[model samples]
Target: MYTRILVPVDHSDTSAAALAEAIRLANEQHAIVRLVHVIDLAQFAWSANEFLDVPQLQSSLRESGEKLLTERVQQVQEGGISVESELLEIWGGQIARTLVDDAVKWKAHLLVMGTHGYGGLTHMLLGSVAEGVMRHTHIPVLLVKATESK
Candidate 1:
């Protein structure tokens, strides 16, 4: 049984679905769930125009990530699950690597995450973090694909 469950989430239906699954598993195993939200300030800030304020954009991203983590933590708590959360802000780093590192650092028994399940051209353009985690991590991972209605 998974005594420590790690769940990485974002502001997406896929992520929400993954959190739901994590909560269920945590309840079943009487485990503690650690929710993580990663914000890549470098990628997001550089994607904007030169006229945009980089510092301001980074701050906003951090705030947004914190809000998302707070909300998700509340949701998990409401489910009567033992939960904690972390908002990771990276300048320019691999998200999957960060997740894996966190999972290892936390001694998580299982890492649960969501996937959009994009294929072909879309997947090539938007690289899959879940796939990367699956390929790189030695820890067990649970991938929850977003449903159409979600």
Candidate 2:
């Protein structure tokens, strides 16, 4: 029933796992996959714009994101799935919020992403993005961890 699958990949191993799952689902359902990569500019997180040209840094980040998306899109296409991609730039560290917003804007039926599977202290400190998305949006989310259990 899910025809619009949104896959947010960060080029990590866990993200790769998520992409694989999304592709498999897409193949089964004859769905379209939208690949998204959000560029979080760390330099803007603190007071440090003097050394970094904002536009230049943004451009560099966008280019890197595009490259990442291009490779993943190719892989999905080769797997016999239709795909489209976009690179989102958010200056602050609210990446999870941006992702949720993008999902709505794209009219995505589902969000398939990777979770680091952090727990306890690490989870408290890092604060999971997948978790954030889940809390903020009612959209059905399929979180694929780095590894699977038997």
Candidate achieving the largest TM-score: 1
Q: Write the per-residue lDDT of candidate 1 for residues 72-122, one digit (tens) a residue.
A: 999999989999999987779999999999999999999999999999999
Q: List pairs with backbone clashes in candidate 1.
A: none
TM-score of 1: 0.94
> Candidate 2: misplaced stretches above 4 Å?
51-55, 148-150
**Every model's TM-score:** 0.94, 0.90
Candidate 1 displacement at residue 51 in angstroms = 0.3
Q: Candidate 1's C-alpha lDDT?
A: 0.92
Q: Score each candidate by Cα lDDT.
A: 0.92, 0.90
Highest lDDT scorer:
1
Which whole-number lDDT from 0 to 100 does residue 106 have in model 1?
96
